[model samples]
Target: MQLILASKSPRRQELLTLMGVDFKVVLKDVDESYPQNLSPAEVAVFIAEKKARAFDEKIEENAIVLTADTIVCVDGLILGKPEGEEHAFEMLSLLSGRKHEVITGVALLQNQKIHSFYEISEVYFKSLEAADIRKYIEDCKPFDKAGAYGIQEWPGLVAIERINGSYTNVVGLPTHRVYQELQKLK
Candidate 1:
């Protein structure tokens, strides 16, 4: 069966390749907005399922479609991708010397049936100096990442103290879980 990845994230694409999976990328514009009543994890799952549903009619019968969304949450608030440099700085400042949850929700659609799950990873950051934050922002330009940071980038190298769950989950895709789920289909 062919595997179709419905996302444009390079990190996710790389991870899938590392897993030795031959997949095709199918890009779609998915509306990520969710209801205010949903929790952070639920919001992530909602968006992922929404993306998968968008490709339901387009996928081949012998193909499986995978869709995912990642969100960073701290103190009950969800911090999505930053709007700009200032927003990135504010997000980094809030995460300094704190631990936050990174949740990635994944949906697999095959034969018109959708299966979904979520993975949560706890990431702890060291106390970051203003200058260091500024430099990281300038160097990384993490405007496309959640919480204004990528756990595998320069900010991650200098700021991340530890993580309590799947490291790949923080990278945008929970690889271990993904492999297991894919096995079930086979």
Candidate 2:
């Protein structure tokens, strides 16, 4: 039985490696769109499960396949990856001086069945000025991240005031919870 990871996210790979999991990375494309009625948390789980399903055919009997999706939510709205520099600016500006939630949903497919879970983290940002936003955009240019920011990068030092949950969840994976769940499968 193989342990496969169905994702292309480097952060997820890094976290998995940190846990000493011997796994193979195989990219699986999945529709990220969700029903309009679904909340941001639900959307994350839905997408993660969708990703896991993409690997159904390739899984060996008794193998464990993992997939996950992450999203940033502010005031009930989902903030996805920025389309461009201008969009990054807008996301960062909207997150300024406010509290937002980061949700990550994970799927573990094993024994021909799927198990899923989600984690939510609260983040509070200090007020940011246009200069601050521009400097971050030019410096870190966190265009690849959700909400146009990476909590482990430059803006993380200057913009974040407090966090009420898993710090790694903001980085893209919830390592602690993931570890605990995988141990059960072992």
Candidate 3:
């Protein structure tokens, strides 16, 4: 059976490729907005489902389509990708010396069947100074990632102190769960 990745994220594609999954990329443009009352996990799941809703035409009877959305939550606020350099610094500064949760929701779809699940990982960061944040921001382009940081980048190498769950979830996807889910289908 063939698999379709319903996103344009390079990280998600790389992870799926690493697992030796034979898949093709299909870009589906879907509105990411969710209900205002949903929690972070629910929000992620909602958006993921929304993205999957667009694949009704692209999916074949035997083909499986996958969609995912990642959210970074600190306290209770959802921190999406930064809009600009200043916003990136602001997000990183707030996350310094604090613990946050990374949530990723995945939706697997085929003809008349949809499976969706979410994973959460706890990440802690050490206290970071302004100059350090500045240098990291300059060295690493963080504007495209949630929480204005990538766990695989420079800040992840130095500022991250501990992680209590799947490390891959922070990079963008929960690969282990994704692998198991795929196997069940096979």
Candidate 4:
């Protein structure tokens, strides 16, 4: 079956490649907003499914389309991508010396059928100094990352104390799980 990834995130693309999947990137503008009544996990799944719906009429019988959304949740609050440098700083400050959940929701669409699942990884950050945060913001400029951080980047190398779940989930995709699901689809 032909595989189509419906996202523009480089991290997700890299993870899929590392999983040994030969796929093509198909970009679609998806509305990411969710209802206020949904839980963090629900929100992630909802957005992922929403993205997949964009290809409902376009997917071919022999093509499988994959869509995913990742979010950082702390105390039931969802932290999305940072808007600016100061926002990034604020997000890092909130995450300092705390354990937060990174949830990535994935949807596989083929021939109008959709299967959705989510993976949650717990990430713990060490106590961060203001200077260290500033340096990371200045150097990395992580405006496109959720919670203003990327688990595979410089800030993650220095700030992350430990993780309790799939490391690749924290990076954006749960590669092992994705591979398993893809095999099932085949």
Candidate 5:
């Protein structure tokens, strides 16, 4: 079966390729808004499922469409992609010396049947100095990443103390779970 990845994220594409999966990237404009009453995990799943559903009429029976959404939650706040430098600074500050949840929701659709699941990884960050945060921000420019940071980047190298779950999930996608789910489809 051919796999269709409905995301433009380079990290997700790279992860899929690393899994030895032959997949094609298909882009669609997906509205990522979720209901406010849902939990962080639910929000992630909702967005992912929403993205998968966008390709409902575009895929064939021999194709499975995969979509995923990643979110960072700390201290009861969901930090989305930072809008600017100040926003990124605030998010990193909030995450300093704390443990946060990195949740990635995945959905697979074939023949209009949808299977969705979420993976949550607990990431512990050591206390980050203001200078370090500024330097990382200036050098990496994390405006496009959720929570204004990438777990596989400089922050992960220095600020992160440990992680309790799938490291790939923290990067963007839960690769092991994704591989397992794809195998089940076969």
Candidate 6:
């Protein structure tokens, strides 16, 4: 079956390619807002399923559409993509010298059925200096990333102390889990 990826994230596209999967990127704008009562994982999964369902009427019989949403949660708060430099700085500061969870929720749409799952990875950061945070923000311009940082970028090289789970999940997609789920569908 042909695979369809419904997202605008280049990171997800790159991950699929790295996995040697032949999939086409199909973009659709869906409301990402979730019910406030939902937990972090639920919020991610809800948005992911929402994205997949947007293509429900348009998908071909032989196609499987994959959608995902990644979220950074710390101290019961969800940190979304930063709106500006100050927001990014604030997020980075909050994450410094702390453990946070990066949750990537995935949904697959096929034959009018939706299959969903999530991966949560714990990230530990070293105590960061204010200057370092500013420098990273200025250099990376991570306005498009959840958590205001990319685990594969500058911060990953120096600021991160350790991670407890899938590194790919922190980057965006959970490669191993995604591969397993796709294999099942095949």
* lDDT values for all models: 0.94, 0.88, 0.90, 0.92, 0.94, 0.95
TM-score per candidate: 0.98, 0.95, 0.97, 0.98, 0.98, 0.98
Q: With candidate 5 superimposed using the best TM-score fit, by how many Å does residue 106's alpha carbon deviate from the native?
A: 0.4
Question: Model 3 off-target regions past 4 Å?
Answer: none
Cα lDDT tens digits, model 4, 1-186, are: 899999899999998888789999999998899999999999999999999999999977969999999999999889999999888989999999999999999999998999999999999999999998989889888988899999878757888988999999999999999999999999
Model 1 whole-model lDDT (C-alpha atoms): 0.94
Highest lDDT: which candidate? Answer: 6
lDDT of 2 at 84: 86
**lDDT, candidate 2, 40-144, per-residue tens:** 989999999988888777777888898988899999999999988899999989999999999999999987688999999999999999988988898887877
Q: In model 1, which runs have C-alpha deviations exceeding 4 angstroms?
A: none
What TM-score does model 4 achieve against the real structure? 0.98
In model 1, residue pairs whose N, Cα or C atoms come closer than 3 Å (at least 3 residues apart or on different chains), thus clashing, are: none
Residues 48-144 of candidate 3: C-alpha lDDT, one tens digit per residue: 8888889876677879888999999999999999998899999999999999999999988878577899999999999999999988888887888
Displacement of residue 48 (Cα, Å) in model 4 is 0.4
lDDT of 5 at 116: 97
- Give per-residue CA lDDT, model 5, range 19-65, as digits (tens): 89999999999889999999999999999999999999889886999
Against the correct fold, how does model 5 do in TM-score?
A: 0.98
Name model 6 segments beyond 4 Å from true: none
Q: Give the local distance difference test score of model 6.
A: 0.95
CA RMSD of all predictions? 0.7, 1.3, 1.0, 0.8, 0.7, 0.6
Weakest ten-residue segment in model 2 by summed lDDT: 53-62
The C-alpha local distance difference test score for the whole of candidate 4 amounts to 0.92
Better of 3 and 5 by lDDT: 5
